[model samples]
Target: MTQKNTEDPSSQKNDSDCGCGGETGCRIEAVLSVDERGQMVLPKDVREKAGIRTGDKLALISWEKNGSICCLALMKADNLSCMVKDILGPLLNEQDRS
Candidate 1:
């Protein structure tokens, strides 16, 4: 028996079709499968292209809409920390005023 490609066509989008209308926007690089142990391996080429190396840490982020998970994203741990600070810095300031 053969398995059919179950990938969504929209997920095969390029940067232009990312709905962001930007040349440097995100793209659907590859589809991955999680094993029975709930582990997934990033393809070697994809990892190389993204500059991911051994012992690197990644932060998993999820987006929810209407109480359902809509998207999942991964970013470098250091970058994630910076982003959290950038977002929460202003919010923390507001709390100080209150």
Candidate 2:
């Protein structure tokens, strides 16, 4: 049996039959306060849903569009050069001797 999360009916918005809407697909607002140390804590449930964990790096992107600031979090891009060096380090060293 699956457990259902209870939501307030009063807060529910009428969904359009076309179903094209926000990225979350639901209209819910959550307000959070930032600390004095320039840190904002992500809610546990939101973090878990996004597959974020301790020691996992995240990139913060900020943009100014339409007179408002927008921020987003994304996974860090891998350094392909580092991986290539690790794989071809021995072969490159041998070539330098010739």
* C-alpha RMSD by candidate, in order: 10.9, 13.4
Runs of candidate 2 with Cα error greater than 4 angstroms are 1-29, 66-98
Task: Record all residue pairs in model 1 with backbone atoms less than 3 Å apart, i.e. clashing.
Answer: none
Q: Which residue ranges in model 1 land beyond 4 Å of their true spot?
A: 1-24, 87-98
Candidate 2's residue-wise lDDT over 1-98, tens digit each? 99887997645666432233365465433556789997888788877876777886666545454556544434433434566688899899999999
TM-score for each model: 0.61, 0.41
Candidate achieving the largest TM-score? 1
**Tens digit of per-residue lDDT, candidate 1, span 1-98:** 99999998756866333234335476777899999999999899988987889998999987665676666778889888998899999999999999
lDDT of prediction 2? 0.61
Q: Model 1, poorest ten-residue lDDT window? A: 15-24
Clash count, predicted structure 1: 0
Error of 1 at 5 (Å): 35
